[model samples]
Target: MEIIHHHNLAMKTEEEKLPPLIQAIAAREIAGFDNANNLHLHDLKISILDANEEQKQVSISMPSSPIEVHVGSSTLYPMSDSAAKFHSQPIPNNNKLKYQRFDSFKTWSGKLERQISNLRGKPCEIHENDDIENLPLDRFFDALEGPELDTLRASEEIILPENEKWPFLLRFPISTFGICLGVSSQAIMWKALATSDSTKFLHVTPEINLALWLVAAALVAAVSAVYSLKVIFYFEAVRREYFHPVRVNFFFAPLVAVVFLAIGAPPPVAGKLHSAAWYALMAPILCLEVKIYGQWMSGGQRRLSKVANPSNHLAVVGNFAGAVLGAAMGLKEGPVFFFAVGLAHYVVLFVTLYQRLPTNETLPKELHPVFFLFVAAPSTAAVAWTEIRDSFDHGSRIAYFIALFLYFSLAVRVNFFRGFRFSLAWWAYTFPMTGAAVATMKYADAVPGAGTRLLAVTLCGVATVAVAALLVATVVHACVLKDLFPNDMAIAISGKRPKMTRKWRHRYRRRSSSSSSTTDSDYCQGN
Candidate 1:
């Protein structure tokens, strides 16, 4: 190859310049060369390219395109030696001439490093997953997409993505209580269909029995999946326990226990053992609920302002759930105690949440689960009242009527969820619908009239369909889209609790900080 040199620019005589031996040493000292053959061709090309812009234009279109060169508003191409010069006329700095290389090589090498590193993962795009709605799968599929399968196999530790600095895994919302609520709802339906003597459920043929068992199996599978998520939520995210308002969801544990107890064990399993297991679990959950409610009540009327949406009804639902299970277990006083506490607090919360408009921006309308609470509390109360009072009396009638009214109100406004993104909050629809159905069945059995029976059948069918839709949506979003949780890692990591202020301000600040601090949302978009 032809070489470029600054021989003509030399001010010294031939003898004044060092011999080849000394030059080799100088090259080694300046650029760390290992041999006389070693050359800084890239630096030479850049310096040469800088020497004369007019000359670079000629180089751009030539055969020397083997080596890439970048020029202003031009493509990268190789340059000839003729386009290079080791030393040129003085460079201008601060509008004055300064003859210097100015350590520009470091800057050039650093830029190259950045460009090269960026190229590695850009070319291979992950193929888009198939549309979930088209897939034929069961609800068990919902648990398939959490944390990578490879990561789980490789290590027991949860290796969160870089942006997941939050203390919890994905599914960390208080609305997750709805998962247990959903299981309980299904379990309640199963119990009603298999055991109720009403005309609506009289066709308990072999096929119906098999279908009910299938529903039971689905309930069991769903509970296990949701419980695994809970372990990730509570155990891995130990610090999040301090997120006080969300603590209300802990009631879901007891509610789950109630469902299991209500279902009882199969023929082979000892019923007493099953009862003991549920009792063991519910005992702590009940105590914890007491402590948590005490803390909130201690805060008094001022704390009432911090109450979340209708989802807060899980607090009352928990007590009602416990009451149902307790009454089944023959614990008379416990059921009545739980029923009284649940009913009183729920009424207070209902009035409070009803008067308070949804002013928080942190909860987008699409993701909001609070409205379902309207149906949930009264329906749960009615079910609990039947179990506690041993009949669907006037009190149960009142609770069922109230829930029916709320259910119709929300049903008329079902368009709200159309614009909403799929979230764990959607599970909110399941349990409440089931609660209403269970309440309706109890009402039907008591009244034994055509109108009551028809309403009971209608409610049962609607609840079944609603729960089925929610289960399918959950499977699609959780298993297919892998979008069970929003990217709230930043808020969780910030560990910033909201001060008792206007709900909107607190919510706005939370969302702003979350978006600014992380790219967690981008991961969801990619999936």
Candidate 2:
């Protein structure tokens, strides 16, 4: 590229020596020529007239077909006009430029002229004789004819592309079963509160318990239907979820919800349905337990210590829930067997989490609510032991006290549970609180007193308020915000990290700087 500086100006190699306006115009012209020709042939020349000249012009010349530019008071004109006549015409100074070019140099030269005019704060104009078919917009649409146009029309008919067009049922996650688990546990807590002698003065009624059970049952049915469809239509997705370390724990939730429903069944249905449901559900629970628990002990990729998190408590708690239901239905030996299996694993899992083992999985702050499961497991075990022995015995008392201690241990760390945005993980708070409330009620029965009764009522009230707040927040999040179904399939199918939103990205950065133990992959698995 050669630049000719006029008015006795010295030839300088540095582009910075040119005036700012000329420099910008020259740079844009060079870029346009390079893109259009896709070659490095340096045959372009730019002529810059002295600023003091009466008719200062910046003319760009190309080897193939040259075009000249005349700059006059922020307006551009074609080279065909004479210098004297160009100034004589009364042209509107709307800062618009008009030019004509040959077919060979039409694309790049026209773009260069428009950009130069714009650099001088002016618009580019097309002459009346210019073909409308050669306009940029018309050319773009012309290229999209035939198959491309038909594909565009078909896409416009649908809301999303073919790959992303998933039915609502396919979007439902197994973790959503946690909602049914929470509601069912709440129903059982209400039933226990109504039946206890020491809390009789609170005037809790059977009707309230029954109503809560019905709501829980409806939720279970809906969730079950959606998940069943997922299993049939997207069985691969189901398989992926089953293999996830954190997500696999929630697969036990639906069974636990069904067990709670059976335990909390009204007096009329409790007799016939309780025995039948216990027998039917027990087989599947034991089969899953054998597979999962065997893997935990046998030493492989699925070792317990490797995947241990507070969420794993879900699997342990299911066994206790089954034991409680089994004992309630007057099964003597089966409940004891399930209780022993659950208690053995509970001790190991609890200690692993407490020690914060180096190999154990770490959850992000958003999932810290599952830490409350520490309180749930022991509390459910306490209730199971009480039902098995037909009384809140000394052994049951010890378990209840452990649960009470853990509840206060977690409750005092207010910051650990606050500041997290609403998610399905918030459902983690509901069942654990309800479990503690039921344990406290049983404790109150063992030692009747005003203080004991007050403690039970307070825990029950807190559990009730937590569940109600979660329900409202979930409705607003899913309906108003439209963020409930993020379709975070990366973790399961692709082994890629879920994309973080702006708020979560900020939080992740802040937490990352403060702590180095957790990594980006851990955050993906936790969510």
Candidate 3:
């Protein structure tokens, strides 16, 4: 029996080159044969085709005899030119490979195209040389252009997802309650100026005080309604803010604003409403005081030294403010109780801040406005003591002097107050300034003199002007600029990535990359 075997292998490249394709075919054929096999060939022929479609052939005729053939096998597996090129290249690490898979899938499914289209008119360029698989995470961000780049450049700002119905509202921060606190405190200061006998010369009328209180009430109602919506819609954000070291202090501001409204209630509305409001809010304030004061004294993550900053004075100021409202409502024991707790904590906080303990976290320069809080606590305490005793005696005067000294000290460092762009934090200046002014009015009433009267008038004027300026600036920022609710600190602390940016598109890339061990927790904690 005679058997003949004819094997044909065809290979082609984009260029349709003859030499490389023939070499690949030969390699594949030789690799298939075992070294131990013996074969006899009568005729051997090789054929090649070039890009032009022209064929060249070679033929060899062997002698009419059976020829033994033994071919050695190759250790390396044979591959086509393209496969060889891919295999020869260096393999990326697991992280890069994972990102490559994700990018490939995103591109295949057209999700990437949909995202780019959602950017509207923003221009993005992908160069021909750019390998999406091998692109560095940072370089990918750098390649982004137009308004998309601007959105990333604004480090404090973030774009909300398209699915969100009210993106602007979601960005609102808990610190915005400081606005209510400042405005209501201003109403109180104006009422003090209008009602007090010593300052009757300033011509502050009942109508002016009434208007301020009305405006403050309107602001408080508006802010409360908006924040209630935020709490319902974004409870996780609210929960994170509640646990924040600095921001948790501002939770006291909303309650304090209500208390101020009750204390400074216009003559037309002061009778039963003031007492009812005070009684309703008293329990929550004391409960918060116990939880916060306990945390401070217990020595843990929320300990005083770890979290102490000028903002902690907000929690201190609330107690004194509540004490003043209690005294006004004819509650004797409750007023003294609140006053005692406030005084005890204020001393420890004051000394902690004054000594600048190494363990204490420091505030960013943009938040330096809260330093005025040093003035707020003592001044509120002085007023609280005066209300509790029904007279501005030695104890009230001592606290008032400390506040006055700190106010002047902070006032001289003009550079500290200036240079920062307007923010919700600027409201920190208003309530504290108003508190100091209220204390000064008490001082002027206690000791009538030219110097004391002038100082009283000056502080009241400054507080009024500061509150007015901040109010106007906040309006313009919200209406014209439309950037009043970026929630910088909240976003930073909560570890939520900004939406609609390329940075978040490859979040998995960042996670998988061994070179980038940074996590959301690390980023949030570091900030």
- State model 1's lDDT: 0.54
Candidate 2 stretches greater than 4 Å from native: 1-167, 357-362, 490-527
lDDT for each residue of candidate 2 in 373-425, tens digit (9 for 90 to 100): 89989999999999999999998998899999999988987766776677788
lDDT of each: 0.54, 0.70, 0.68
Candidates arranged by lDDT, highest first: 2, 3, 1
RMSD of each: 15.8, 18.1, 17.2
lDDT of 1 by residue, 241-348 (tens): 323344445446444634543543232232354446546656776776676567557773215445444556766777787777777666778778878888888877
TM-scores across all candidates?
0.61, 0.64, 0.65
Best candidate according to lDDT: 2
Model 3 lDDT tens row, 1-527: 12222211233334444243232223234332222144343445555455456665544333333333333442332432232211111334486533332222122323355457568765445432122233232321332211111113222232222232334445777778899999899889888988886798988888887888999999999999998886665554565466655567778888888988988888778766646677688788888888889989998657887667677888888889989988987889888988898898999998988988333233444566877888998999999999999999999999999999999998887766665577887898998899999999999999999898999999999998999999999999999997776634332221232354676556535533522243333324434
- What is the Cα-based lDDT of residue 134 in candidate 2? 33
**Model 3 local distance difference test score:** 0.68
Instruction: Please identify model 3 stretches exceeding 4 Å from their true place.
Output: 1-166, 274-276, 357-362, 487-527
